[model samples]
Target: MMKITVALLFGGKSTEHEVSLQSAKNIINAIDKEKYELTLIGIDKRGQWFLCDQEDFLINGDSPKDIMLKHKGLAVAFQMGKDSEQLICFAEKTFTKSIDVVFPILHGTYGEDGTVQGLLTLANIPFVGPSPLGSGIGMDKDVAKRLLRDAGIPVAKSLTYHQWEQPGINFEAVVEQLGLPVFVKPASLGSSVGISKVKQQDELFAAIKEAFAFDHKIIIEECIEGQEIECAILGNEIPIASAVGAIIPQQEFYSYAAKYIDDQGAAIQIPADIPKEIAALVQELAIKAFQVLCCEGMARVDFFLTKEHNVLINEINTIPGFTKISMYPKLWGISGISYTDLIDRLIQLALERNIKDKSIRKSY
Candidate 1:
């Protein structure tokens, strides 16, 4: 039997580029070599793609702040071939490799916010994670919360502001609406990049400024007092949710540094110490949000579980971290799926979704 050829795409122009490298490293280490032939492709900060050597793909791999993609390999471009999407490398000699599937380990902005998904869709290639529409909806917190709230899902009250509205943003008015200790975040970013916890009225201006720097739009939400709970969802039409997990962040919140940089910044509590009933509810809501957001393949549904057992939808990560300590794989690991098995499942899911999508008549 021929092994499946998997193109692992990592790094990007996003602020989470370093985090994506870490994720790609873990995925490459854990993926089953016997069942899959891996082609490593790293995207640089400028959005250029290069075919990478699996062993020597990264520079400064040990230091998170300085880690970068080693751009020595053949610069590549994705093109739609006669039968499938081809990765064309134009160097001393031109060659093409047909990719069976793409596992985009990229997080944030250009990679996660539907841009790459759209490209893959146009090429009619099978890639892991949500569809273009799903990725777009999942990346925008402001849009996601509105959809969830409309579907009768509980979410924290918030306000959305574009860069143009900066001059009119009244800190006192926002405080009056969302209350104190609001979270200011770039609307379409993840890994907690450009997110600030505004505790005082004076801090609101700086927080908004910081968030707007990363994105054209920002969201301000009332800080919900509760435990940070997360549930991982897998599959397409009828997805299943994994056992719930909790993030015990040592910082004021799960900042970018706390997530990837600091080893002891956060403690991950698997099978969160919650009642079975609450866990079940969390799983139910997780699947609901996944479906509501049009997510397929996989997603990590974050929530705020209050002392009263109320679960408030926070946000959805279409391409959640796959790092050694990342919650997505860890939650599934505790739920009877090993890391390799989880990767296999995701690949299979992507293939299945592609077949289903192809079945739909395009000309009719």
Candidate 2:
């Protein structure tokens, strides 16, 4: 059998661009070299698509300018079209590499929000992770919460804000309604970017303002104090849930620093210290949450086990971080699936879905 040619898409135009590059590096490293041929594609912060071969992408410093400089001259332009239009130019030379499949290591915004998925759909290429609709909903915290709530799944009570809304409108009322120590997050970001935990009225405004800088919409939810649990969902039909894992953040909450920077940021409690019944319920809810958004390929369903011992669906990550340190792959690893095997399964699912899609009637 011929090895599948996987185009690993990463470094997208989003707040999590650096994180995406890190994830891509991890995925590229973990993919079984014997079973797959990797082609690395990067989207710079300016949204320029590039075909580049690099190893271990990392932030040069905290400054975006320094990060951009390190990657400045490495990008090769790419443009797509029908048949003859599919041309890529690098250093005034044209080349073509037909992609059998795509493994997008994108985290937030343009990557996980369905923009890249939509483009791939138009290109008639199979790509891993959620479908466009699923990706869209998964990327929006507000919408995800509403859907889970409607599906009879418990989610934290949340209040949403649009970016264009005036800042002075009855924030006190919102706090009164939702209660204090609420989490304020950008509706579309991941890796805890633009997320703040506010405990007081003064801090609430600052959190909202900071969150709005990353995205127009914001979601403020009452903090759910419990074990931070996560389970991985895979497959199109009869999706299977991996062993549940609980995250123990080393800070007041799971902030961006704790998620990526610190060495001892979180401790993973595999098969989380919960009752067998609660585990089963969490697994079932994870699968249900994945399907609610019409997800395919893979997703990481997050939850909060309350002090009362109730399980609540927190959110779903369609393109959960592929970093070896990331919870998604780690959970699967403990569930008897190797990182390489997990990648292979997702690729298989993508190809299977693409073939099925081609069989669908377009003129109906």
Candidate 3:
């Protein structure tokens, strides 16, 4: 049997580039070599793609702040080929590697916000994770919350503001509506990048300014007092949710540093110490949110479970972290699926989804 060729894409123009690097590294290490042939494709901060050598794909150091993509690999470009999409390396001697699928281990911005997904969709390539529409909906917190709320899913009260509307943002008015301790975050980012917890009136504008630096739009959400719960979702038409997990952050919140840099950032509890009934409800809501958002393949649905057992969704991460300590894989790991098997399942899901999509008549 011929092994499937998988182009593992990582690193990107997003602030979560380093996180993506770590995810790619872990995936490469855990992926079954006997079943899959891996091709490393690294995207730099400037958005250039390269055909990276698996052995020398990372540089600087392992620390999230210092880690960087080794750009020494041959620059590559994705183009439409006679049969399908082709990744061509531009060097003294040109090379082309046929890819059976793409595992884009990228997070945030261009990588996660449907740009890359759109490109792959147009190139007629099968990639892991959600479709382009799903990715877009998942990345934008403001849009996601609206959809979830409309579907009768509970979510924290929040306000969305674009960069142009900054001048008219009244801190006092916002406080009156949402109360103290609001979370200011870039609408389309993840891994806790450009997120700030503003507890005081004086801190609100500064937090908004910080969030605006990362994105054109920002969302200020009322701080929900509860446990930070996360559930992993898998499959397409009939997705299943894993056992609910909890995150006990050591810091004020799960900041970017705590998530990626700090070793003791947070304590993860598998099968969160909640009632079995609550766990079932969490799983139910998780699947509902996954379907409501049009997510397929996989996603990490985050929520806030209050003392009263009320669940409020935080956000949906289409390409959640796959790091050694990341919650997405860890939750599934505890739910009877090993890391390598989880990867296999995701690849199979992507292939299945692609076949289903192709069967749909494209011609009007």
Rank the candidate models, highest TM-score first: 1, 3, 2
lDDT agreement of model 2 with the native: 0.81
lDDT of 2 by residue, 152-197 (tens): 9888888887977746546677778787778888888888898888
Q: What tens digits encode model 1's per-residue C-alpha lDDT throughout 156-241?
A: 99999999999999988998999989999999999999999998978989988999999999999999998999999999999999
Candidate 1 similarity to native, TM-score: 0.98
Best candidate, lDDT-wise?
1
List the global CA lDDT of all models.
Answer: 0.92, 0.81, 0.91
Q: Model 3 lDDT vs. the true structure?
A: 0.91
Model 3 backbone overlap count? 0
lDDT minimum window of 10 residues, candidate 3: 77-86
TM-score (all chains, Cα) for each model: 0.98, 0.93, 0.98
* Alpha carbon lDDT at 255, candidate 3: 82
For residues 266-288, write the lDDT of model 3, one tens digit per residue: 98899899999999999999999
Report the Cα lDDT for residue 11, model 2.
81
